[model samples]
Target chain A: MTALAPLATLSRRRFQLTTRTPRELLVPLVTPMLFALVIAPALKEALHTGTAYEAFVAVGTVGLLVPLNTMFSGLSVIVDRENGAQRELLAAPVPRSFLVLGNLSVALAVTAFQVVALILFALARGIDFHTGAAGLGWFVGAGVLFAIGMYGMAETLANRVPKQEEYIARVPAIAIVPWFLAGALFPITALPGFLTWVARFLPLTHGLALMRYGLLGDASGLEHIWSMGSNTAMAALSLGVVAVFAAALTAVSIRVFARTALR
Target chain B: MIEVRQLRKVYPGDVEAVKGIDFEVAPGEIFGLLGPNGAGKSTTIGMLTTTIRPSGGSARVGGFDVAENPLAARRVSSVVFQEPVVDRSLSGRTNLELHARLWRVEPGVARQRIAELSDALGVADLLDRAVGDYSGGERRRLEIARALVSEPRVLFLDEPTVGLDPRIRHELLEVIGRLRAGTDLTILLTTHYLDEAERLCDRIAVMHEGRIVALDHPQRLRHELGRELVELHVRDDLPAALAVLRAHGIPAEDAFSVGSTLTVPLRDLSAGEAIATINDLGVATAISAREPTLDDVYLRLTGDRLAPAA
Candidate 1:
């Protein structure tokens, strides 16, 4: 059987579920701007950067919020399990992997929309760096990839975690701690020598750096440790790393969810 | 149609839920797995529905091996679990159409089938309202409509009337009874409700402690107790009553007591002979005669009362 039709239908349902509930959309849309307003000025003079700190915080906010909000979508799995909807869906004739993909795709699209809205919100808030349409396009791409990679990790947790209480207890370690270590609140170059090394390997580091490059037009200036090449080549390298992150984690999550969903 | 052979499921920590039971259901038949909670009725349904992996043996649904070809098996069958599964946030029509799409029913055909199934299930009037607004029985009707939207060949209902009030339960029963009158669908339902099994199933397999203790037409199973039961009440002296009956050629083993009443199976004895024998003994007691029921059949097969809960 063709997987396209069912995946599309399931994706549509996920999208419908998301839109019908406005609270899920709120964190992605409003929380980033709140961060730009509240945290950017406090760190403005403490850390010197090429762009205004508000601009830096704008990309950081988007970077952190996009993945965090998308990952939270995994909570739906637990809710469906409690309510018996998951059993109904599992008994359907569709391939199990398609269900994982459907969840991933809708998260990507919703976060992509959030990316655009956040950019416009930053502009309206008077945080200026890049005004080009192509830059906004790159921001959306980075947000989508960031969401994809993190959502994959979330699905793995959702399928494997036994209870909602346990899953929520783990959200900080899995989704939040990485952002702090990855320099979403600031630049990783400010971190200590050993902590900097730890930050270099995280997908969130590159994802946040890539998003800054797209919106701030300075490549976040945090890529020098891994690159001796020009800034453009550095940006391309960050994009490649984030793409690999998205693909690998998504593949693993689909496999894990397929086996774990059965009783 | 459904078939199972030597099916077993040993849960983690070595809890054997279903132990090598065998049965088959013909197409268009209303087969039942009757047992109280934890008797492995739900576990057997889980295996046949492809939600649970079988530890050993085999099961097939609509000719597809559940373990080897679960998706194919799922395509030809549907299940209504004991748990409430309909999405309460959405309207009944939306829920039905959503399920239709997941099963890849063509959009046009899905719409038509949604309409038909809702009308048939008596949920047509409530289709436009969100399911959260529905009563328990209404939501159940909508769930059944959603299961039927794909037009499955085999339908599994696991305790379909468990939580409903009596009036609503019988109402749902009538809905299912109507489905049983037709030959287009095969149904496998589980219920501890004796009267439901007695009224609905073409044949039932009475399960106890993970095995099929009895499998036959409901009437035949009840026949194990006898055509009718002779009820004997003694104010006191049950042993004397027993001795008196045994002296009249009715063995004490053939009669059992519940409270003050001693129930004697009226195998060949007419009510008059039993009454005359009691009079011959010059004993004072109250007596009555009644037909045997499925409750007696289950009690005879398994000493435990067939309760509704796990």
Candidate 2:
């Protein structure tokens, strides 16, 4: 426990910040709901696919929540630089892993709330989420990997960019725009044939397919990808892809942050 | 407690921020780096504090090489950065507690140390308040307390009084003076303010353009010019006036001019004698003699006044 004290303190700071101003959490919470209220009706009416739209779009919105909340961790790092606290933290004798993991810890804690809220919203819409414990595990594992991998990208942008304006303009586009091209609103089949390959390569596309399959018990979304015969194989492959991506990006982000932070 | 040998820093693009410089601070001495902006004072502090790695050479704080083993150097030292480093969103106490954890201070001892530091710094009552609401002075005092929580062997303060109002700056100076007197901790501070260095530092290194042009005790740095200085406020033609004074048998080698003011070291003549001797050189508008100061020493070496940057 003593060895974990630094991480514990890092985790505790997020709640303290939330206590001071509950509004930091408010923006991320309101984001998915706003999309649901404003955009869901038009999209659902256009699809003309009864009830599948809500279930599909809800999972998509859940995808949005991963980037929505996790990206704040990167923004908070920039804010820390402005206030000079980041430099002091970098200068401390604590392990570098503590600082990076501490940020991920905060992102995950906030992500839990966003995930639950979206789940409740899906249930409220009369959407039946059909799955057993294994499917649920797939949903959990897919979401965690997607969150960590996306967070690494966001943090890398935060460290690499020198100007705050550039970071603000680019981080949101990188974080939020992927859900659009991926299967967030429309599945990959809806895209033009050339764009289908682009959508297939996006990590979120696979993560979203697994999450939608986890809840809806439909692997039709995963069928076109390499023409896999079974949903289990597709799910396993997607999990591997996202896991390797998460690991690679985590390694890259850690190296990038160390260079800018230490010197 | 702090030793620096040929410590240098060259930023990317071949821009040298700190040229090779060597200086050692005694175990318990309060040493100051006095220079104007762009003189590399903060860069020196940054390198010594291990925030910026030196491009060449080495620095050690508390016997650990900052570059070879930065973590060990960091463990035995803390720094009060030139800018506010406390988390404004957290309570003051939480900020100190977080620092304690970062340094791995034992929780039981950390609590007691935090209590004692805040009380001594006159911020114990405000420990639970958010740091965003703190006045500048309160925030600064808390930064100091946070730095001290680790019980570091060496402390670096980079332009500690840069943003404070004069009264708060004075009070903080007294607090720092009291702090040094009460402990054997070695302290190195960088400042653009001549008075800050004179009031707190036992030895002062006057830096100019990334080099330590003069290093000595504050009074001794001043003493390099003699006991007192004869200052002549010239109306115009500074060079002409200096030349005229030389024709009047004043040694041309010992006088320097800055901004229409001519300063000649008063070695062989009294203020009145020097005044009468150079009176009506036609360029001389006013003349006065006074005891030497760090400002005089800094100006002589750097050709710039070490004015308070704030």
Candidate 3:
């Protein structure tokens, strides 16, 4: 019971921070829809890939939304620290890792909700799930993996940066730039050699590839999977890559927070 | 119980904050750390609470060494920071519940403790309101209630009444007085208010420039000075007034003229006798005798007033 105390504290704090402000819930909900509406039509027209292009854009939009929402969740730590709540919690008996986990859980829950909503909106607009239930399940799994990686990375960055304005400025650049480079809206193959090499290392690039292949049967050849012909094998490989990234980043976040936040 | 010995904090850039200060608080004692701003009082609290590490020496709170067993120390103690540390977006009840959860209090016990502490702190009516809506004093009381939610054996309050109006400060002090009477909780309080320290502390440690210049019961400290302050308003010849007062057996070293007033420290002289002596000197337009207080003790020890310097 004592070991789980931190998790319970994190759970309650997540609810309080996420729900206390209407803007916290509303911004994550509305921002992705606006991006989808504005960017999907233009991308579809430019690529001339018909409805499939819209599906690609929807996957890309979810990729963007997951990290952005997770970053906002990570920023709550900075908010707590600035407002003195972090000091109170730090002085408590709970382990410092709980603060990172608590903030990440809130981010994951919020990202999951937004991803499902975006996918439903896409389905309403006639984007078919080529592999049906199996594909949709994999797509949501990929979204969760992306959210975990983003939450970890964002939590690490938020701990290192002391000022809120600096965090606010850096988050969009870190979140959106990788999102664009990950071939969410377009194929990374179109980029120059340097950027293409950089894109391959991004966790979102792998996540977007898995999501695209799961839902549409191909990732526009942006991602390389060992079993190219089998969608199941490809999804499994992508999940494996995302899992590694998630584990490594989460470890780093916890380690950095233990050193910095508790200090 | 709390024990600190030769505790030191030297921040980066070679700035020394707390310089080898030692003090102890027995169980259920209210110990006040009184000092002006930048006097290292906050730094001392920070070290004892495990928020800031000591650069040297040791501190133990509730039998746990602060540096070596910080978690154990934290488990036995709680701190109400100088700043508002509650989540303003949440209700005071939610904030207290969050603290209870963090401390791993059982649910039934937590609920009862929260209710009792809120009522005791006079924040029961404000518990359900968002802390953002609370007045400064209300927020401070709620912070204290939150700290109490853990039922810690020792509580550290860092300038608990800072930025509060006089009425609120007085009311909060009364609440603190009641809290001490009703519980065996050991409290280590830091403040700049000399009167508050005089009224509430069992013993007060006066800190200045990263060192404790004096530590004793308020009255004992004042009595140790062995003099009542006598201030005289002279119409003319301030030096002559000082010479005459000294000739009457007041210590010459204790006589000093400030502006138009001649201030002297009188030992073993009644206020009436001091007034008569001043009147006999024929140099006084107005005169007043003041009992020695913590303020005078602080001034004598630190050469600076307890209040913010103008």
Candidate 4:
């Protein structure tokens, strides 16, 4: 099932383009860091409780910003389609899945770097994490799942939209609605009735809830056993949802790609 | 090596881009789908090359169904799109190498093929340079090189030289000819350039408004028209001479007229007979006999103007 050589070739192609200009990386990396360092601090007082304010913002920032890199990088897929390389790739003899997955791997790898940088910054800035190595592993794994999930949304929106500008305009609303409503910045406990009900379905709400539990030892809102497990449950559930989203998005993307190859 | 039957493609807006078009391309032959812009040449090529699905039709490329057996068809064919497909941020060799990988070429063989294709396409010197800085012609050549890396049984080029300079167009045409001479490749080219169809196509299929109007060899299409074109230059009464030709069963066309020059299609008369008949009419000035070209045949079948320009 592995077309290793083509995967390597696509990876190399992605790397070359990324490195050639390097300006493409500036937005994804810098935007997240800026959000983590400057925006989070400015908003911390308004959003945080008496204690664990820094840790709360750190965990939330990691979960929110980690997903965005993959989302941003997946925009390259649409650009490639516009330029006709996507057509060329689809028309090639390689297995259809590799084209998407191979490119998706590049997005994942790139965003992985950004996730690590964010984590290290949080640690250096005096954020705490309990459960030691176990918690830390869950944190990193959650970041990966977050990236994959957002990439799923990116693929779906990018394929469906008529223009990149339209996708750009809509992505923020999509990302922010889930992240903010999930209580990443504020507590979902204090939300209005309709908003609180809606927050239950947001994958980020569950994921961030778990992250906060892992890092700060504050298992607030652990109503069920899945919730009691906190970090493990969040990582498992989000990864599960992400796997399904990735698969469904990929299946739909393949259909869209085939329909559009000659257009 | 390619057969299309009753091929139809209708877009979402109820535009039928291909309406039951049928044609066959012989092995190792250069077949051209020629038409004006928006005549469904690209759509037909798209269908044949497995880039797009047919609404209700079947096309067998290299003896495999493009609809049901797309992978097999793709394995044996390569398409060079009308638009550029190279990754501009990557070097030329890297671009070709990516294509090579998609075709699943082994690493050692991919390396050798890339080298050979670059040398063949005359981009050996620029293999390591980014394609963004390359001129249009250079980029075009690089695309051709990328297409050749797979050495597929059939090659599809959709409007390969629509906006290129004459020199670059000629150069690209030469490269295509060389590919035929050097490899066992069945080339299918779609173009709006009548001259290009005349020069490169072993057989030409003329399409208009999503249907195959005529399909034949360039010379045969001309011969099939069974007419010689006559251009008459008159010092005065240009309209009168045109009227005379119309009255004589030969109508004057705009393609015939320039600086008191008027062209009349001598459809029913032989070239010598037409010239003698015109001389007897005393329309003034000289008459020049022209062999029927694809343009003449095109004008005859679809009228002088091209399908109202989409």
Candidate 5:
């Protein structure tokens, strides 16, 4: 029962936060599609090879959308803290880790929905996958990892920035900048050497690379993979790396959240 | 049910909010922490509930050390913060249900407890409405209901009626009284209202500068100061009236002018002697004698009024 407390909390928060109307659902769904539509056509000629540029852009857009949703969802912690609801949860008998996991669970659900929707949209646009079922499976796996990692990053930011105005002003820089540098907007090779080095360390970069390998089957010429390796091996390596990063960030987030929450 | 010894809270900056305070609360007792603003009443409650760590000393809730075994302490205690903590976007019922689950209450028990608490708190009609639409008093009652849904052994209410209207404050106090009569829950309430402390508390700890200046039953604390308070409304020559009372063997320190009102604290002196002294001085217009009150005790101990001018 104690171990399941977080799941119960997650259920309540999910119900409170779930989109209530079609219009609300359309907002998160349409924004990413619009970005893909506007950017994919412009980059088609330059990046088109084995895979259509539209597919690449769609995968990258899903990567961006997942983190975007997770970051915004995780910001609810800051709202809860500011409004004093966080204190109620903190003072409860449940472990502090439950609070962190409960908040991230909402982010994870939203991310999964966005990823699946984008995959369907890509398929409708005539994008081909190397291994259809396996590709979809990897996409879901990578999206979950990316979502969890971003949730941790956002929770950490929420704990550090105590004031709403400060959090509002600072969070976009932290959340959006990494997506741009992670090769979501453009190819990693197009970036300067220093930026490419920095992007290699971002979890989203690995996530996007994994998704591309899953869907397009190793579009190495398009800067999807850093080395000329087996598509299966590269995909496996990316998944493993992202899993480690996600777990590490989750641990850090729980520790920092417990400290700031009770401080 | 609750015990603390020299509990302290020092913030990051060298500022000490709660400087070494000690107190104990027994089962089913409504203990009050009475103090002025910034006297560390809320800080003390925070430490005991395990929401804030103490810088020094120790506290125990239901025999569980709050610092070392916070989960156990939290299991036995619940706190209603001074500020509004209910989620305004959620319905009152939803808020209470969520709290019930977070505390690991069984589903059947949670449903029954929520219904009981909402009915007892007189919020049954408002439970389905969004908390954002509820009035301040309604929100306060719902928050208390949320706290009680967990069936905690100790309840901490930090200035539960601070921002409500007087009528609502009276109503909520009645609800608290009913809650006490109905349950074995121990309550630790903090308030600056002297009447509130006197009316509701079994024992009052008057906190000043983060220390317990006086701790006793309200009547005992007031009686320790004196039996009666005399106020003289003087028309002319206030000092002469004070001198006349002193010359008649009244202690000079007992009588002093506060904004043209000569106030006196008397133990056994008769009203006739006070009236005769004033008449002999020929400088007084009116005089009145009243029973000792918590206000007098607060003024005597802290040299400051508990509540500020409205």
Candidate 6:
């Protein structure tokens, strides 16, 4: 229990620093809302989707924003490292595993609320729920796991990049643009054959597929976990992917952090 | 107690910052890591405090390994980093609380410790104001206060008084001295100010080019050099004066020409004898013998003085 205390403290500190100024929350919350209300609707035709473009994009945009927040929020780790706060935390008598897990948990919590809000708004705007309560549970669960994966990816980026601007420029494209190429707005079947092939390798494609089918009941059932397979199997598989990705990225992130610290 | 054995850190592209330095500090002793700019004092502190990993060698704090069990090592250590790491937007109390959380002290205990440390550091009156409103010296004091909240077994202070006015530097040193006496704190500090090292550190290590060149109690370090430093303002070629002293079999290795003054080392001689030797050279107008200081010891080891921009 004492060994776990540092991890608890680490989580508390990271969350405190993330919320140090009320202004820090604005970018993560406002950017997604902006794309959802303004930019997303305008691109409805350009996206070439016949679904209720407004609600479809709101859900999709919110999903994309999770990854964006992951990258942007994770930049705080870089700031802490440079400013020596990371050193303060690392030096505490806490488990290293706790530090990593606690940080990802905070990242997941921060973005999950906004993602759910956007989903609720879409539902309020007459987007039908396909899988009822069961599907909604899966949807929320997928959002949480996706947030975990993106948080790990973002932390890794923060460890590697020298300047905040470089990360700012790179991670959005790496983490969010994949959502577009994965058919978050328009189905990937409509894309050029080359891009469809590319989408197969993307994690968000599977995630959005799971999410859209759960929400609209319109996606091909093969991809979404709740529909094509038994609910338990789909849940297990989605969580397994999330666990694998988060674990791998976290390992890489720790190494990068340790290297930079030593250097 | 603190022990650092052959600790070295080499940066990328083979820039060796700390090169296998060794030292041990006893409990309740203030040990100063004295060096000029780029002399690896900060790098060495970083490694010892667990902020930066050592590329080679090892260190321990309170019998715990810094590398193998850094958290346990750090549990007994705290650092007031050279740069101000306080969040400018947060109140001083809030800043200290955040650090308190990292160390996992109960909130009630943390508050009591914060109150004690803040009062000791003289920042208790300013606890509610944001740190941004505080002056540089105040910020430094607050950082010291933060480091003290944990009541660490070993305290690492990196250049704690740099860029400070003499009065505030003195006050801070006094505060540190009080802390050292009032608590069983083993302190390791790095500083370029010789006076600070002489006054605060029980023992000092003169670091040069990432290596420990000399280490001993401050008084012993001075006596070991066996020299009285004499600064002479003479109207003669400085190098010739140095040469004349060397020719007379006086080892003046810790000597340098600074402006119109030639600061030279007179080995194994009384002040009168040193003056007579300079008189024999027939170029001395005025000369003075100050008691040997850490500056002289630094000069002896590094072959250079802490001059402007060295």
User: Which candidate leads the pack in TM-score?
Assistant: 2
Order candidates by lDDT, high to low: 2, 3, 1, 5, 6, 4
Task: Using DockQ, give the best candidate's number.
Answer: 2
DockQ of the candidate models in sequence = 0.59, 0.64, 0.62, 0.55, 0.64, 0.47
Sequence-dependent TM-score of model 3: 0.89
lDDT of 5 by residue, A1-263 (tens): 76785567755665475552233244556668876665576577656643466766777788667766766666678778887478888888888888888878767776777767877777777776665788767766887887888889888888888776776687567667887888776678779998888887788888888777666764552245457456667777778878998998999999999899887
Global lDDT of each model?
0.81, 0.82, 0.82, 0.74, 0.80, 0.76
Output the better candidate (2/6) by DockQ: 2
Winner on lDDT (1 vs 3): 3
lDDT of 3 by residue, B1-310 (tens): 8999999999889899989999999999999999889999998988888888789999999999998888899999999999999889888999999888888889899999998988888899988888999999999999999888898999999999999999999999998887777689999999999998998899999999999999999999988756687878888776666667777865535444546765566767777887887788777899998877787677666662211211
Tens digits of per-residue lDDT for model 1, A1-263: 37688898788878877787887777656666667766676577556553477787777787677767876788877777776377888889888888888888888777767776777777877778773776665565666777888999888888888898898899878877887888777678899889888898887888777677777776655463465457667766777888899998899998888677776
CA error at residue A132 for candidate 1, angstroms: 7.0
Model 5 clashes, total count: 0
Score candidate 4 by TM-score against the native. Answer: 0.88
Question: Across residues A62-171, which tens digit of lDDT does each residue of candidate 4 receive?
Answer: 66675566667767777877763777887887666666666677778877776677878877766666657766655555555656667767776777787778878887
- The alpha-carbon lDDT assigned to residue B250 of candidate 6 equals 50
Ten-residue region with minimum lDDT total, candidate 2 chain B: B301-310
Q: How are the candidates ranked when ordered by DockQ, highest leading?
A: 2, 5, 3, 1, 4, 6
Single out the weakest 10-residue window by summed lDDT for candidate 1 chain A.
A220-229
lDDT per residue as tens, model 5, B234-304? 78666666666777776546454556676777777776676677677666677788887888777656653
- Model 1 alpha-carbon miss at residue B63, Å: 1.1
Would you list the clashing residue pairs of candidate 6?
Answer: none
lDDT of 6 by residue, A1-263 (tens): 36566666667766777787555565777767777766765686577654466656666776677887788777887777665456655656665556667877778777876677776765665655556886776677677767777887887788788888888889768776797787776677777888887875666766676666566654552253234445456545655665676667777877766666555
